[model samples]
Every structure is written in structure tokens, then in C-alpha cells.
Target: MNRTELRFALHLIGFLDSVEGFEDGMVKLRDRRWLVWHPDVMAALFRHDRDLRHPPSRTLSPLLGNRSVLWLDGEEHAKYRRTLAPMLRGTRYQALIDEMVERSIAELPSGPVGLAEWTRRLTLRITGRILFGVDDEELLAAFTRWLDRRLGSRVRTLAHRYLTPGTTRFDPELDRMLLHRAETAEPPALAAFLPPEDLRDQVVSLLFAGHETTASATAWTVYWIDRTPGLAQDLLGDADLLEATIRESLRLSPPATLAGNRMSADGMVITPSIYLAHRRAATYDHPHTFDPTRSPPPPGAFFPFGGGVRHCLGKDLALTEIRTIVTALLRHRRIHLNTQRSCTPQLRGAAMAPPPSLAMVATCRR
Candidate 1:
């Protein structure tokens, strides 16, 4: 990691003991001025008075699309969120678990396999089916390529979004597929409020968010579980332990490490660091340790999917997918990390993914 990235990681992991005493819980970085890491203050910033602040749309618009719910705030954000909420509810999420399990089982290799890569592919397939209603191999391949290119760099993504013609429009066949699925599947009520363009952008945004973050979380969960002997069996036997395992994995290594930068209407900048907040000693005992049995961090302190009104719309879907993947894996196989080398976190695009070389060996459980 570069110096800046290393510093950020240290902050996120609570290794920087010196930061525990910044005045008002604010630290200045570069010329941008204030960076807030305190859990309580950051939580309040997210939960209260959201109307006065908005995410950094200028930076994200190119990738998420200008009309995406991620870029909207206040009444506009609420309107879209309400329309999309039903599709991500527990029942809807539960309905997708069987398919998730099937996919994970089908994709698992016989020996050692890169857990992160496999999970990314698994999540991409799952989200592709859910969002587009079809899992055409060619379509998924194309989407993965596009996502890889766009997420590689912010400058390049902006250039591509602006310079490339028809970049804002969904593929014709994919759009038709989604529309057809909407006829039978539970679709978001976006058409009532948004134009076709905005609706398309919203669907695309959801697909990106749903696939990437869940993949990272699932990989990390598997990595941690594999590291601890008997934990996988414990997770399979106890439902609460399974839930705690997922929560602790997210707390330790949230995919979306930082919340989108929020700029106040009055020209003040409020940077909400989900990573740092998760590591805050005040919010968690032994913040760096991965203890599934630990009491859950209080509400706002552990926000892997973020907080407040703009919290990830796919939070339920992501959690369900992670639970389903982990449960299925454990039930079918005993998971162990390849002990030849240590696994670490690596920044991939917008998420902190498991190291590319990190592999898990899964043996069929008798």
C-alpha cells in the first residue's frame, strides 16, 4: 500500500492510537480540511439533518449515473428509496437464497480456490439474475468486463462515461429482459416517478452495488471463518453465531470502507468514515479483534451498508446473500485457508477485497 492508503487502513483498523484524541473528533487531511472519524459524531451527521448535506455526486455521477439513487438526496432520495424498498425486503431476499446456494455449490472448485475471485463471480451471477431476470453467460461476461473497466479508475470512468456514445443507455436486449422480468417478478415502482433513463440508471446502480459489496463481504467472512478452527462448524450449528459471524466480519472489514463524502449546502464538507467508526474503541471492545461472540456494536457504530435515509437499498439482499453463501459452504464443506502464505486486504476499485491470491481449500464434510 502507498503511504496514504496505509494511513487510511491504519485509521480504519484502529492501529493509529494517536488519532484517539483529536479535538472534537475531527482530523484534517491535505487541503480538504476536516475529516471526521468519531463514531457518535459521524453517526449523528448521517442520521440527523441529512437534508442539509449531500454525497459527492460530481465524483460518483459518472460511475453510478447522475440519476442514480446514490446521487439523490432529501425528498428525491426518499421517493426512489420507497419505491425500491419492497423488492429488497426479507421475504423477497429469502426467495433468492436457494439460487444463491445452488450457484455457490456449482461454482466451488475441488481443491484450493481464490475465495475472493469465486465470490465475486458468484455475486455477479446472482445479481445479474435478480436484476436482469436472466443469467446469459455472454451478458454476464460483458457486464463484468464493463464493471472492471469502469471501476479501475475514477478519471478513466469519467472519461468513458462522457466520451463514449450510448454509455448511459442499457444494452437493448438486457433492457428488454429486465422489462419482461418486471411483468412477473416484483419490480421497483420507479416508473411512476422516473423517466425511462432514470429508471435504467437506478437498476444499473443497484446491480453494481449489490454485486460488488456483497462479494467482498462474503469473501472476508469466509476468510475469517476459515482462519478459526471449529468456527465454521459452530456457524453451521448455531443460528445466532452465524449472524454474529457475519456482523463481526463486516465490522472488521466493511466493503464500503468510507461513506460517500457529504457536502453541506452551506459549503462545509463532512466526510463520514464507516471504516474508522467501526474501529472506534468507544464503539467496540478490542476493536481490531474478530470476536463473533462480542456484543453487537450499537446501531450506527457498525454500518457496513451505511446509515440514515440513504443507507444501501440492497442491505437486506446483501446480508441474505452472504448468510446463504456462508451457510451453504459450511454445510457442504470444511473450509481452510491455504497456510503457505498469509492473506491480507487489498483495495479493489471502491471496495476492500480479500487479497487476490487468498485461496481457501474446501473438503467435502462427511
Candidate 2:
């Protein structure tokens, strides 16, 4: 590994807003390693997933375990996706998600709340119920502790990558709880559909991927809505506009900056930078500005979920949860930003997250 390049990547991923002189197109980071952000290149790479393979197992195996879908490729990955895609897309699950969102919203604390923390809990609660088939606070809290330790900071993220057997104190027990829940869960629980052999890793990966990324995205969307004058009120009436606003929020602060790294047949490593692609002026008018009124992005120009057959299986579920929470919260309460200063993205594990200090105060709507 090129130590200097690796360090630069880690810093950029952790603190995306700090990046300067970022350009579109393919950037060669090291011999045989490249970063591609140009919409055309991203489209090409995503279109031909078979030509590219995932990063080495050691990179993610420690945190997600050996059998995580993130590590699978070719037929194995395709089969896994086929099994899970229908469940996530099922209308039956949408009803369950709406119920969970309403319940979570009812529990939202009155007065000032940290946006990141509040959303994290909301998503964890929602995701836990789906994956574990129960709302066990102890399990949720333990998982949070474990996740925070692994991806709380740039240092921790790097160490987790380079260190041997990167596990927190909550392991073994948490693993057991997740696996047991998945195996025993009945229909309608997401865990019930998961394969038994890969139960542990799959459940862990789903919880982390399902909640963490959505939590960050949800928080960022709320932050932007509060920042824009009259936008929240407008959203209450216009469903399409509400989606557009969320899309804009995603464009500004994509939860995952780089789609997973892909290895080419010739030993070249290529990664599509969603962050960069979304910022191209050609694709987005006044790219840096947050304007939901702006024209919709072209097909390849916008990809909060990575492109291709490898696109996130939980995309529909995530959007449903986000839309439900945002719609319910807006309808039930009027929330305003606690600080005048804007919030920026901070990398939390694999997600680009809002800082914990970003807060808002909510008052029930009369």
C-alpha cells in the first residue's frame, strides 16, 4: 500500500467539505489505482460491474464479517441480490415502515435536540425493529456503541482498517443477538428473509448499511429544509417538491462519497466518486447551491445509490423511511435550526454524516 496516498484518501473521505481542487474525470491515485467521477466514466464503470471486482476482503471483513454482501461478487453477489431485492421492494414492507416512522415520530423529544443524534436513534429504532423483529433498546444501544468505536473518527476508521481483529467490546454478544434474531424472526421481519449461512454478517451489514447511511441522509435533509426559507411549508403541500428537496439534499451531501472501489481486469483500481459527479456544473445548475427548483439531473449524473446491478438493494426502503419521517415530522411539528452557522459533513464509518452539534428545536404545530 502507498502509505501517503492511503492517508490522503482517508482524510478526504472523513472530511469531504475540506477537499480542494477536486476535478471531474479519472484521477490516477497510484499505479493501477484510479478515481473516476466524470459522469460518462462513472456510467461506464457502473454499467460493467463484472469487469470490476470489490476491494480485498481484509478491508471490510473485520467490521462486516467474512460473508457480507459487500465482499461478494459475480454470481454469488447476483444471487444474494435477487433474494433480498424483492423483499425490500415489497409494498407490504412499506406499510410496516410507515408504522415505524409514525411511532418513532411520536417518541421524538420536545424542545431542543441534536439532529444527528435524534435521527440516528430514529433510524436505529426503525432498522432494529425490521432486522431484529423487536425493539430491544439494549441491543440497539450495544450496536451503537460498537459502531461508534469503529467509525467515530478518522483515526479510529484508519486503525480499524489496518489493525488486526478490529472488534469492540460489544462483539460476540451483539453478533449472537443479531444472528439469533434473524433466524427466529417470522414473516414481515426483514431478518426472516436472510440466508442462514450468512446470517450474522448479513444482518450486521444490513443494520449498519440500512440505518447509518439513511440516518445521515435524513439529518442532512432536515438541516437543508430548515435552512431554506418557506421550503418546509411548501413541502407540506407538494409531494413531488418534497422528493426534489430530498434529492437536492442528497446531491449536496451524499451519504457515501465514493461508490465501492472496483478492480479492473488489468489490475487497475477504479472508484466512482458520487460526490464529484453530483457537483458537475454541466449536470447541476450552480452546482454548489441548494436549489430544489433546479432542473432534474440526467440519468448518469445523479447517483446517491451507486449505479449498475450493484446498486443498493435497500434503496426503496431507505427512501420510504426518509420520506415518511420527513413528511410526518413536518406535518406534526415546526422545527428550526438552533445555530445560524451551517453544518458540514463528517465521515462516520462508511457514511458522510452531519456533526453531532448540529441541532434543532421543535414545537408542535397548532
Candidate 3:
């Protein structure tokens, strides 16, 4: 549990514009510096893992988000990012997660359901089927446990599984599958587009990034829509607004608040201007309210995906997942707030994995 005062301090960052201030309503927090003091900064902190020296340490472990790509950095990060870049950035790979999402949505028969878990299951299923091509009951369970943190993924326990013969060779098996898929698939296929090892890393990257952020963002969008009336009507009326809602929700309640950090190792007298970007009234109208209908956020107004060279590599996948889920949601149901459940969310893992109760009662349409 995060400190209540700390959480309040973090939430205040996103509301900086609410404070009367400079033209943009942004406040200067320090010398020659303006800050927005955004709420989502807390989410960013959850995303960035700066210490690479220790591969599997108490503080920084490669989020094996069902085998994530977060562990690699520097040259490894660049290489992995490049190989998989086109798969999502272009039209061909856009539908990769879409197909999986459609199948997952098919499971939601016309009735009331747990919107948070439904969203999580869709995201997890997409990661499983489309991204990593992983299919292991125990590994999936372990992955969920690892994510939920009711149980931890211990080095010794993970090692024991690998050591035991006939146990799932989760990573290696996927590597071989990627290689074979590349060998057999057409020349322009995604598998063929990436080198063998890079293909493996890319899959892991997609699995981690593809699901987690989208899941959180989707939760926020749902929660926000449920809580805000006019905003919900606007979103439901225009399917197109769904994307805007995602972006605004991200601005209001960022997916990973701390990812914008620039460390000294980044080799510069670095300065961060995230707070200014978020809180500046010039950048957004009524910047503090969770209203999506306000003048759309400014160009490069938010960096939920971070900025500069190490900006989020899986941004496309995450956006695609959010758009797909939100669009489907607008078409099929009306989401109402579950006032009875607690609205508080925890920063799970290295991102804002909202606790599975955002109080979205899904009412089926026709």
C-alpha cells in the first residue's frame, strides 16, 4: 500500500493547473522550472526500472510479464525495439491483437459481468495467443500470481520448475517456435521480419507491454466514463471519441506515471518537464477535471508512453488494445459506476495495474 500522504502528493501533480498560476496555469516548482505535478507521475514511477546491474534483485527484476522484454536495455533494447517496430507501427500488424481481442469479447455473453476482470482476461489472452504464442496452464497461473502478488515469483521456485524434467520450457520453447514460424511463414510475415533472438525478445516485449498498460488504461477509461456523466454520453455517442478518451484518461490517470525519468547514466545534465506539460492550462482546458470533452490535449501534451530515445516501444500495441476494447465496449454496453465497491487502485508491479474493482457495471445493449 502506498502512503496516503504520498498518494495525495502524487495525485496533486495532475491537478497543478487547477492552481491559479502562469498563463498555462502551470506553477513553477523550482528555479527556472515549471511543473504540472501530474497525478499520473506515480504511475510512471511504477514503470521505470533503472537498475540493470542486478538482473534479478529485490528492487528490480525483469517483469516476466508472462515473459516481458523490460529486462533488456541499451543496445539490447534498441535492437529488440527496431525488429518489432514495423509489426505494430504499420497496418499489417495492427490487427494482430485485434483478432485475439475479438475472440475474447466473444466470451462475454449478453449479461452483467466483472468489467475489470473481463478487461484483464482479454489483455492476458491477447498476450498469450497473439504475442508470445504461449500456452501453458501452470505458466499462465504463475504469471497471474506473479502479477496479482498474492504469490511472488521466487528465483528458487522458478529455477526448480525449469530444473525438473518435462516441466515447461517457457522461454526456450517460444524461441524455437518463433524460429520455426519464421522459417515457414511467408517472407514478409512478422516472424521473417525479425532475427531469431530479436523475434523472441520482441514477443516477450509485446506480452508485457501489450497487455499491462492497456489493461490499466482500459480500467481508467471505464472508471472515468462511469464516474463522469456527460463524458460517458459523448463517448457512447461517438465511437471515435474512444481514442480521445484513452488519451485523456492517460493524461488524467497515466498508465505508468514514472517512466519519464531521465537518469544520469542517460549521459546529460538532464532536466524533466513532465509536470509543465501536464498542468499547463494552455495545453489543456480545465486540465484538472477528468473531463474528456475538454479541448483535446495539446500536441505531445502527454507522455504516457514517455519521451526521447527510450520511449515506449510497444506503444502501438497498447493503443490498439485500448482502442479495440473501448470501441467494443461502446458498441455493446453501457458502463455504470459500481458505487458500492472501493474505487482505490494500487500500483501493481511496475505500472498502474488498477485493482480489479473500478466499479463498472456493464449493462448489455439489446
Candidate 4:
């Protein structure tokens, strides 16, 4: 079969996603892991993925290597996930969607502005309100600045080499707590969850990865849906169709372009390529095309949040946030791409971001 055409067809059918699919793809990049069976192998990869600590594997998805659990495998991964479980349940996250997100988006400045940058703001606000219970505007801006510095600089790459295990670095938590506690009182402060150094990293990862990544996915989805007039009509015409559109969009531009990485210390056939498998299952059609009106595949076909035990911890939160924001946008405002729009990819550490210049505008309902 002609793989290229097949890739194109999948996009036409909405089977493969472009933005994030490349992140998980094996055909192009080197040193990556993709979950094929998803419900099976992706789970297996995450379950045994901790081998990174031993060496050879070093770090999987080095772009997101700082996440604490990325180095843990098997029972260890489970233990950490268990502790984090209560905080990220689907239902609890869904609750935050309704009460907090709408008001925040409603407050944005209107008229031909770049929604790409704003999408990041929208993700951060929901995460701040729901998880940290703090929304100090200035502190949030500071953390965003620090995060941008860390991700968009070469010093971090140097730290990966020079700052091994014992070397100290400025704590990532100091800013968020200051931002939250300094501003609000209702849920009180998070004087408790701040200590365990490693837990702090998780919070940082949650903010950076949680909101930024989801916002990228959400922004692209909104843009493409608007580009495809028929698909936008489909979503506006049917609620069930909304979920399908989101699923297809996620398949196209995944937040993390790459999936998990694995190494085998034992006799295990540890094939380090989750992104490839993700691209494989969704193979066919212009894999890069952004077509929302596609057919749904069987479970585990598109491995974005990953597969198995090592799946993303904040997936439910991200989904709730995206759905809430998208659904809300669809409900009130009509979004249109400005004809003179321009955006360039900015490198932020391991993440890829559209330049800060990326801009769009939406109209408020009458």
C-alpha cells in the first residue's frame, strides 16, 4: 500500500491527526516510543517505562523529562499515580469546568485578537482555580515568565548535564503558591502540598504541561473547525458531534508531539517507539490534514494521552478544560480566523510554541 496516500486518506477520514501525531510518529524522528495496542502495549510501556533511571534509556521524551514519575516504572508509577488520583478525578475536574472557566473566557478582550495565546491563559486560569485555588493575576504572569524562560533557554539543557541529582536549582513551586495564597482565601492556601520538593515539580509540570499543551490543542481545534464550515455546522447542530470533533482534532495536533520512551534492561523486547505506533494506527490519508468530520476508530487506536498504566495523569483535567472552553466558545461567541494572521513556531525548551505574535479575534453574542 502507498503509505503516503494512506496517510492522506486518514486525514480526509479524520483518522490521523497532524499537530500531535508527528510528536508520536516514528517514520520521521529518531529515539521515540509509540503505543500501538494502546490498551495493551502503551500500558506495557508505561508500566515498565521506569527503566530510564537505570541508564541507556536515560530519559523518555527528554522534552518532558523533568516530570518525576517519568523515571518510575511498574509499582512505582502506580504508587505516585494513586496519590495523585483523588485530585484529578473526571467528575471533580468537570465541576471546575462549569463554575470557573466560562467567566474567565467571557472576560477576555474581544475583536480580532490571537486566540492562540489566550488559549494558554484560559487553560492556566482553570488549573489555578481548580487545583491551587489561587488566581493572583500578577503572580500567574510571573510563573508564566519563569516557565517560558526555563523552557525557552539553553541553560536548562546545561542543567540536564551539570546539575545531576544533588545540585540545587531554584524551586519551581515558590511562584505558584505565592501567586495563589497571596491572592485568595476561600479554599485557603496550599501551605501543605508545597513541601515534598518532588511534588512541587508535579505542580509545575501540571501548570506548564496541563494548561499550555491543552491550549495548543484547543486553539488548533477551534481554528480548524472554523476553517471547515461544514464541520463547525455539524458541531453546532449536534452535541454528540462535538466530542467526535474534539477527538479528531486531538488526533491531529497533540500537545506533546512525542510519546513515551522506553529501554529494556531485561530480555524484554523494549521497542522505544510509542509515537510511531500512534501514527501507525491512524495511518492513511494526509496525516497532516485537519479534517474534523471523520469516523471514530476502535478504542486505543489513537494514542495521544498514551496507553496503559503510564497514561497522562492530568488527562481528565485537560479534556474537561478543553471541552468546557470549546463548548463555551461555541455556545456564546462566533470565532473566525483573521485573513492577515501570521504565526511562527517558537522553541520553548522541549516544547514547540507558536510565536507570541499569534493573534485572532472572536465576536460576543448580542
Candidate 5:
């Protein structure tokens, strides 16, 4: 395995071996130190530890900015998250469901396509319209091109340098496009609260987080549903089953496999392994199986979205989007896996993405 995969495997092995107790270890990988923790320790750290803070990764800080909510801590983080919370509530997102469904239906391919790429494009479009109030195809295309390079790049340092806020400027035209949208837009609920200087970074961060995670989750949802015979038909008639399917897919393949690493002001590091936590046998019966009919896992027990104060602000909106996309796709088309190989999750940057080669055929439902 390559260095990144090796690090992930070590952490996973530690988690699997310590399913009954807390697991903590320090590892030096690529010249940086990481303190990884399983759920037992994570529960305490997430709840009572006020000092644990998300230290910006060398790669992410330049892209997300110092002021973005993901990098903020304590009062600043809470304040920023609170401002953005209203836009993600169920009532607000419910109003957008029809539009989301319509868009997915229009964009879905009628023949074999890479499911991951298709979902990423659809989610990016939905995020662009909802968050920025800009539906210009060319602008969205540019943003997708820029974002894909950053996310998919293998040259870590170069990608970090390219995205770092002041080291090198973003494309002038794209900057103007985003700034113009921010100046003229409404909704996304948090836009009004962002200062002019911080607006671009915050918007970029939101767009990245908003589309990337949902794309991974939605892609996995499609894979699992297609793998299970009769699953689509059952979901078509049952709302609970559909919701359960989404949850099960998330449980097995959370997009954000690892929560952001948090470090105390002193010297301690704490990172929560969301992937390991989801697989805890105590919390999930047949932890690895994708069984949608099983009872829902309990709160805190299932956290595809990290927990406590830093919980994802877009959690509700993400769920709504995933449900809408999956429902619309299944309802409008008969999907079948086109590849002979079984699909599995692989790390793509910070998210757990389905195999890049995963292909599926979608036939329109008559």
C-alpha cells in the first residue's frame, strides 16, 4: 500500500483490535505526528474537552481560510455555525426538494456512466444554486474544474500551495464571479453575516464540503441499493425504508471517514475515526453488512457527521439532498451495476469515495 493507505490501515487496525476499549496511538507519517483515537476516547473528547480544537491541516487551511467555520473554535466556531444553521433546517430545505428532484432527473444519464462523477456534478449544481444563487453553467463548470483539480490531485504540497489564500491568487475571473454572486445573493442564511474579506474562502469551503460529502454518500447509496435485489422497489413504496437505506449506506461508508484532527493548546492531538466508530459491533449489529431493514442505530452511536459543537452545519440539508437524489433517481430510472467487480470505498482526499471506476446503467422508467 502507498503511504496514505498505510496510515489509514494502521488506524483501522488499531480501532478493530480495541472495539471494547479506548484506543490511542501516536504515529509519525510523512513527517507529521497524528494522535488517533477510537470512539471510546472520542466520546469524552467530543463532550467535555473544551480545549480540543481543529488544527488546520497544511493542505486545508490554505483552501478553507483561517476564518472559515471549519477552522474556527469555541465562540467563533459556534457563532459562525449558528448563523448558517437556519438555512439547513428541514422546513427551508423542504421547499427546495422539488427543484433538487427536477434537476437530478434532468441530469441523470440514460446509459452507462460513472456514478460517482455523475452524482458529484449533480450535487455541485444543486449546491451552487442553493448556496450562491448562481446557476450559470459556465461558472459552475469552472468551479467544478478548479475544485476537481484540488480534490483529486496526488501532489499534496503543490495542491496546498495553489489553494492557500494569499500564496497565489485564485483565477481573477472566477474570483469576480464568486464575489459578484456574494454581493448580489440571498439565502445560504450565513452570507449576510460574512465579512467581505472572508466571503470567498467561506463560500469555497461550503461549496467543497457541501458537494463533495453528499456526492460520496449518494454514490454509495446507489451502489448499495443496486446490489440488493428488490431494494429499489421496497424503497419506492416505503419512506422509512428509503431513509433507513440512506442511513445504512452512510453507516457503512461515511464520506468523511475521519473527523478533522483536533489539537489542544498544549501538545495533545485528538482525531476521531468516524469509520471505525460506525463499525463498532456494540453499536451496530452485523456492523459491516448493508441491511436497511434493521433498526436505526442510536444517536451519537451513528455519526457520519461528527458530533458535539463541531457537528456539520449542513447535516440536515445534506440528508435532504441525498434523499431527494436517491429517491428521484430510483423513481425515474431502473439502475443496474455495469461492472463485474464489487465496489468498495477508497480514500479521496479527506472523504471516502466509491471506486473511481464504478459504472452503472440507468434506464428511464416508463
Candidate 6:
């Protein structure tokens, strides 16, 4: 790898003491955790996923709640998936997504704006309406405030990571407030679809999981389109190219850098690296370049939503939201990167997003 590529890879992987065995398909970190990124190994792991179990997450439980599907294993995890899968899959929410995208596009802010923040708010609003069945601005704003105060600060985030266990991160006051708002919402919101017994935890998990990742993906797609000459115009004219562009963007910079950590009954711990898996030179021609025109990737090679039975539940919904937002923005406004700002990859909680300094200017097309 070239110097530039090596630097990008490091940012994507975050901190690791050694990559000495990476070329051999798996590498052991300083913590003795193994990350496997090779396509064959990853595929095999997923294929035999029945033998693997999700490792409970201490850091996330307090934030996402103890019962959150993120840390659940065995039948508990499958039950959560079963309850939520039907609602997320298929064309059930496509119209709702397209409507939200158009509304967000129609109200585009004037002048240069932070693209990451812009997309975050947009997705937050959409997620709130669809998931909670309410568009209470006060509630959404309060939720953001709570999360910002806790996870937004670099100092607090570090302290939460190293200073204490994950369960310590939960805020009871905020949790109660969020749950009350969700419970009071009228029927038809996706929140109603969740079982009431687990409503609070499920609401917290869905909202937290749904918004930021989609927003990050949207921001990254816009960045790629802005940097590639005439790409926006090409996307406007062809639907397939727009899809390809979104796929390419996800492949290049998936919002979530890694899949859930898994452990075998035999005590073998393995983590799948989506970032590394997507960038393998063997699987992608010119892996570092953001080329949307490349031919389709092989089946097991491009599992951005992850592989196996535990693949992301929001796959179709996320793609639809991204396609709608990108297509709508390109159709209505001309967007350009604010080149004065850095566009480096930075970690935002669990998601990898364009740096906060990354700005873009969107003006209406005459």
C-alpha cells in the first residue's frame, strides 16, 4: 500500500498494536482479540454462524439499555430480529422515506453548512417520525441534547471508555423521558410495532442504531459525489449509477467500521472488519479509489450490511433512504465540497464519519 492508503486504513481501523499477521488473513490486537477480514474466512465464519455468539457489550448496554439486541445472544437475539425484521424489510416504508427526503431537501439550509451535522438532523427527524410516531421537535431536540452531553464530548467519551464499565453509561432520567415520549405517541409509528414489554429498550436501540449510521452514509456519499467530476450530473440522469455510487460509497467507507464481535462455543473470539473486507485489493480493483463505474463485486465480497443471519436489519431501509436523499439533492440543488475544510475520516462513537470540519455548499439549481 502507498503512504496515503496506509494512513486511510489506520484511521478506519482505529487503534491496534499490531497488523503483522493481517496479510495472513487474521491479526491479533494488543488485547489479544482477533480481527478477520479475509473474504473466505469472513464468509466461513458467517456460514457457520450458528456456532458463534455475540459477546455482551459493557460500553453499549448503558447507552443502548441492557436488553438491547446489540448485545443479546442466542434465542433472545433471534427473537428481537424476528419482531423487527418484518417491519424493516420490503417496500413498507419506501414512500415514507421518499417523503421525508423530499421535505428535507426542500428545506435545505442556505450558505455553507457542515454536511455531517445537516444529514444527522435530517435522519434524526425522519427516524423520530417513523419510529416514534411523533414529530415532537422538543422531544427530538432533547434527545440530541442528552446524547451530545454524554457521547459528544471527546473527554467524556474517553472517560466512559477507559474509566468505567459500559453499564455505567446509562442515564436513567434521559431514558425515562425518551420512553415516556415513545409510549404516549399515537398508533402507526413504528414504535407501535415493537412489543410493549420491551418497548423502551427497543425504542432506544432502534433510534440510536437507525439515524446516525444512515446520516453518516449519506454524508460520505455526498462527499464522493462532490469530489468526482460530473458524477452528480451522471447520477441525475441514471438511476443505476446512483445506486452504484451509494454502494461504492458504503464499500469505501461503511458508517459502522466493524460488525458485532462474535465468540464460538469453543471460546474463540472473532470480529469481522467491514472496512478491511471491502478494501481488499483482491476483491476490488483499485480499492482505494471511489470509482462507482466498477463492475459488480463478487457475492461474498461485498456484504456491507454484514453477512449471515445476523446481517443488519436496516439494510433495505438505509439504502432506500440514501438513494432517495442523494437523488433528490442532486435533482434540486448543486452541491460542492468546501475544499478549505479537511475531509478526513473521524470516528463518531461507533460510526466512521467525515470530520466535523467537512463542509459543503448547496445552492438551488436555476
Q: Estimate each model's TM-score.
A: 0.83, 0.92, 0.65, 0.72, 0.85, 0.90
Q: Which clashing pairs does model 6 show?
A: 58-166
Model 3 error, position 352 (Å)? 1.6
lDDT at 226 for candidate 3?
Answer: 72
lDDT of 3: 0.54
Give one digit per residue, the lDDT tens place, for model 2 in 102-137: 786777678678888888888888877776667789
What does the lDDT read for residue 261 in candidate 6? 77
Please say which candidate is ahead in lDDT: 3 or 5.
5
Candidate 3: residue 133 Cα off by (Å):
4.6
Q: Candidate 1: worst 10 consecutive residues by lDDT?
A: 8-17
* lDDT tens digits, residue span 1-366, model 3: 234323323443333324435553334444432333343432343244343211221122333322234545567656756766665552454566667666665666555566666776678766555443444445445555544542122333334323452333244544554445435544434465565545554554455566667787887787777766677667665756776677778877676644432333433222234444565565677766776566655345677776655567667777777877777766677666555534554454335545554445566777
Error of 3 at 20 (Å): 13
Cα deviation of 129 in candidate 3 (Å)?
Answer: 2.3
Q: lDDT for every model?
A: 0.70, 0.77, 0.54, 0.56, 0.72, 0.75
Report the C-alpha lDDT of model 6 over 218-246, residue by residue, as the tens digit.
Answer: 99999998888888888877988888899
Pairs with backbone N, CA or C atoms under 3 Å apart (clashes), candidate 5:
none
Better of 4 and 5 by lDDT: 5
Q: TM-score of predicted model 6?
A: 0.90
lDDT of 1: 0.70
Candidate 2 worst ten-residue window by lDDT? 13-22
Q: What residue runs in model 6 are displaced by over 4 Å at the alpha carbon?
A: 1-21, 30-32, 153-155, 188-197, 340-342
TM-score winner, 2 or 4? 2
